[model samples]
Target: MDHQPLVSLITVNYNGRAFLHGLLESLQACRYPHLEIILVDNASADDSVAFVRSHYPQVQIVENAQNYRFARGNNIGMARARGSIVGLINNDVVVDPDFLQPIVAAFAADAELGAVQPKVLDLQRPGYLEYAGACGGFLDRLGYPFLRGRLFDRVEPDLGQYDTPLQVFWGSGAALFLRKQALEQVGGLDEAFELHMEEIDLCWRLHLAGWRIAVLPESRIWHYGGGTLAQHHPQKFYWNFRNNLFLLIKNLSANRLWRVLPLRIVLDGLALLNELVRGKWRHAGFIARAYLWLLAHLPLLMARRAANRPWIARGAARTEALLYPGSIVWEYFLRGRRRFADLKYSQAFTRRLAYGRHLSPTQMEGVEQPYGTETV
Candidate 1:
């Protein structure tokens, strides 16, 4: 651990010129000595490539012929990366100068650790957690993804809670750090995901391969959330609903799939109805479109599940340890658990914390209370 491993930091951009100054400047000031920055442009009409080349000459640029969006763009950049540890950061994110040290230290400490995410706060809102990735990401039994400091739309403030480095089901793609070997073992990101939920899908595959994902709060970043796609955009809604179904199909086991898919369809129906009742016609229409897409592509989804069967069997026994046993949708809508700390997780999640065996005493020092104790 004496010699620092090379860290290749890659950011995918599509006409995001205004945000580049903050991101690149912060990266230039990074304290980690062994770091290289890569900028992957997705055929932006804006002069994003020229701007980077002229201003940040040290950054390596990879230009795509067309807009490949998130999954494929990062995949292309990762292919060109020579670092042992690869970090996929969003173009709108600004990192702390010493962020890379803790991330690298965490990987050096645990051989099984495959991915890590920093505690992401809002760039616009000083104290609040960002919507994309708060402390770390997790899932419910029903394939609903949520974060430690964020529920559906409610985000918690930085109050010294969630300070410990702990194992999680997934890390946020906005500032995700991964071992290149693990990414290759999992065959990299599933490009079919296109945009939304791709990182969660990648983390699911890593879990299936018995690699742990964690959040190191000591390394921090600020995200200008929804820089590429607006939060309420219809396309964002469509991708979220559709890609979530894709995620569950590609990763869940057969028995769990049958039990969960039917219930999820019913819940989606309820959501559509609620959206229509609230006069949100476009959102409701997109939800229906997602269902139609699922019906049309059943064969493709089934083939994907079949291909992943071997890994599914390998990880089946420990799956429950990473997932919340209850439904997050029900907890959020019916039980009024808006904050992540308000939901009561089962013992399975508690046991999952034991996976953080490599966490140093200093990292766990001030974590005086367990989760669900401090409700905002």
Candidate 2:
């Protein structure tokens, strides 16, 4: 126990009392001794706050005035956390007894390791991968997010295909384990995101700051997906699309931004059309609204860039290697490449990962070049 670091685990709860008992009970089973659970309740109207206070007095509770959403809610907990390591987990997940072991080990193994996500399996179907983040996340050339065991809508069975630990583009926020140092360095999560895709943005910023994000399949957790929002909810669609666009604009270098942003727009159009064809007219409307909102909030986007200047100034190393060289949308929709193994990367990508580690000093020597179109 002396060798283990104290982990301050935080869960964002919004009317999630029914699942709280299970999560708390599962955590009670964890063998890790140096741990503290912090529950951030986003003004839960139900008896969630009362229940935690009654049954789990040991847990620290942060009550928000209103629904601050995921990013802000977790940021609040991080501010109050006392441990060196921080864990941002959803209220709907249950962890194995050994979950914290591998995570602690991963951080101890690499000084530059900023965050690690466990192998998230579907709670209902333990044999299958979860929707939030199966084994680790990767960004396609078009800025589309996909997991090692999951494509657009396909969740694969857990046959240990992604068992090996490796560097990933992003770690899922569902059961995210992070270093407090890294979290503070990048100013924690971006509040503008409010909900979806915020974790990806945070991880990408960490990458730019010369930190690594890894997936530790050796540590496992079962996530009851869609706890806060339904899979097909229009609000979910709005946040995902909007925040993804924000990531492309705010995070990408000027040269790469110009090249990828146009393709992303066209790809988004195709997705909207597909939704219309499938009679998901409301979803299509959500996407349109997201685009219109982005256009109107150009000033806000500029402000975000200014906020992210610290991480941007740190530059990037090995970040480009984590991205899928091919377009995932085209491969999934046209070529029907549902499995991650089916997706292809150029030989240069393999070589890049091989030699990327040694190029760290050169990459971190400078800041990202600006687009020069407008100032924040």
Put down candidate 2 lDDT per residue, 136-240, tens digits, no spaces: 898986789999889978999999987766667899999998888998887788888888999999999889888878787888999998899977687787888
Model 1 stretches with alpha carbons more than 4 Å out: 346-348, 354-376
Clashing pairs in 1: none
How big is the positional error of residue 5 in model 2, measured in Å on the Cα after superposition? 1.0
Candidate 2 runs further than 4 Å off: 346-376
Candidates in order, TM-scores: namely 0.93, 0.91
RMSD in angstroms between candidate 2 and the native structure over all alpha carbons: 4.2
Q: Which candidate has the highest lDDT of all?
A: 1
- Candidate 2 TM-score, C-alpha based: 0.91
